[model samples]
Target: MEDALRRQQTERLVDHLERMGPGRVWRPVVDRDGTVLAEGGGPLPDNLEEYISGVDFAGKSVVDLGSNLGFYSFLAARRGARRVLGLDIDADAVLGARMLAALHGMGGVDFEVCDFLKTPPSIKADMVLAIDFIGRAVVAKGRLDQVLATVARLARREIVLTMRAVYPLEGLPPLEPGLRERYAKHISDGKFHAARYAAHALGHAWKGRTIHEGRVDGYVLKSVLVFSSNVAETWEEQGGSS
Candidate 1:
């Protein structure tokens, strides 16, 4: 009986680790039940709480792109969103998010493993979060216009976007000379052109607020942009979801 029990316990632990991880979670600052946790190791997550200080999520629905561990998805649900859907490409991360939501009893929150580039979600929402996703895709895929259009379509009310503010490896490790030169051109082009390309895509439709931390000479920091449709403009005029 003892030997059988040990095997069962080991099987259960193996299953759990297969779903969660040793250090793979993007945001583990919250407990399994959504409570905040203080941690050591890496830097704290940049959820952009201050950006949302004035905008209320009550009764709105949110779709989060690249919702690694559902951190922002949980935030939306807790802030009174009627529903929140977190989409990621990683199957294990989506499974982890779903399992954690079950533990937290967060029926308003859901997660799916999806490749938005191929098959975009048919379900649109009041808000779309493309944080740390759009600029990278634009830079890497060279499909700036198409990607931005999809983002606009996903959002019925508002869009919250964030991008890395710096990209210059003037003093980094030695990459192969050709690879390094190509990467340097890519970085230089992306840094100069992504923002302008974004404006051409859909920035003209909505007025926005820009949020940036001052430049760090050698580090990348998060920069945010929040914009709304004509209907969502009420969020600014009324200080909450319209």
Candidate 2:
């Protein structure tokens, strides 16, 4: 009887995934019994541990910004986070993450649809994650400064910011028509470089320490910048770099 019930549950979960279409995802989301629910096209970030090296999420409140499928949020909960909230702009992704949490019985984690730039969550968190979000922002709206300011406000203790770094590589090919048209202005304005973007974005009085700086893929230079609210204020008072 138990085996039959388990099979039925697995079938239902698979169906749910099918309805959510498999596409560009950052990480693969799996169930408690190791059933793969969704498959992402990007390479698995095997260096995730290194990316979050010094930060400890145990007993902490974490907020994952742009939490497309809640992979990092689930990781935080698994690592003993007291509370985990996953926020994303995509309504479908948010719903899918919520369903996955329910399926895994992770009561400590929650998912919500939010625009991190315009209407961020009001609650502050011990740790915040902004992985793979900055690059897209550079192309989409070029409002990195506003986004970083909001992140600084929402983060209490620390923030883990991961973005593609600027490198001496060939320029990106033209995107699809709709996206290309949207990104043309920013691209022509030269807003895609990582260092320049960070410099402009973090113009506010926030201090950050580089945790990890390296290449995630051939074209992407993944960098993790860690920030603490208290430390930032102290650095600003001491006339240190923002």
Candidate 3:
């Protein structure tokens, strides 16, 4: 009887995936029995374990911005994060993440559809993950300073920000006229060095520290910037003028 029920449940899950299409990111998401459910095509070239191996999320409140399929959020919950919130602008992604969470019995991790550029969540977190978010914002011509300020405000201890970059410099490279016009179509944003610069700027603005930085190999050349809290102060003091 139990075997029959398990088979039925697995069939339902697989049916859902067939109806929804492939995951936007976090490819080859599998079940405990190693059943491949969704094949992803995003830029996450590494596994979740490799991406989150060094971080200490135990007993922390974690927020994952631009969390396509709740990959990092579920990993944080598994790693003992007290509370995990995953937010993305895609409604379908959010819905799929919720379904996956329910199937896996991960009630602690919550998924929401939100545009972090316009309005970030009200809750502050011990750690915030903003991976692969900057180039899209650049294509949209979003204010990079305001975006950084919002991340700084919501992160109580640390922030892990990653973006695609051409050079390891503090500013972006110039684009040709043709390339600029192509980027305006929302296909790509050329290359961006603003994430590293913005991370450092936020560290100075909030009196934090640039704790770590390195490259993350993927479909594109990516860089990771980590900012750690160095001082204790009221929200008003830490929230610099926008």
Name the best candidate (by TM-score).
2
Error of 3 at 139 (Å): 6.0
Candidate 3: give its CA RMSD in angstroms. Answer: 7.4
Across residues 157-176, which tens digit of lDDT does each residue of candidate 3 receive? Answer: 88776654333222444443
- TM accuracy, model 1: 0.67
- Number of clashing residue pairs, candidate 2: 0
Candidate 2 positional error at 106, Å: 1.8
Q: TM-score per candidate, in order?
A: 0.67, 0.74, 0.71
Model 1 segments more than 4 A misplaced: 1-23, 32-48, 51-55, 135-138, 165-193, 212-220, 231-242
Q: Which pairs of residues clash in candidate 1, taking residues 3 or more apart in a chain or in different chains?
A: none
Model 1: worst 10 consecutive residues (lDDT sum): 233-242
Query: Which sequence of candidate numbers ranks them by TM-score, best first?
Result: 2, 3, 1
**Model 3 weakest 10-residue run by lDDT:** 233-242
| Candidate 2 runs further than 4 Å off | 1-9, 43-47, 136-140, 167-193, 196-205, 214-221, 230-242
Candidates in order have lDDT scores of 0.61, 0.66, 0.64
Better of 2 and 3 by TM-score: 2
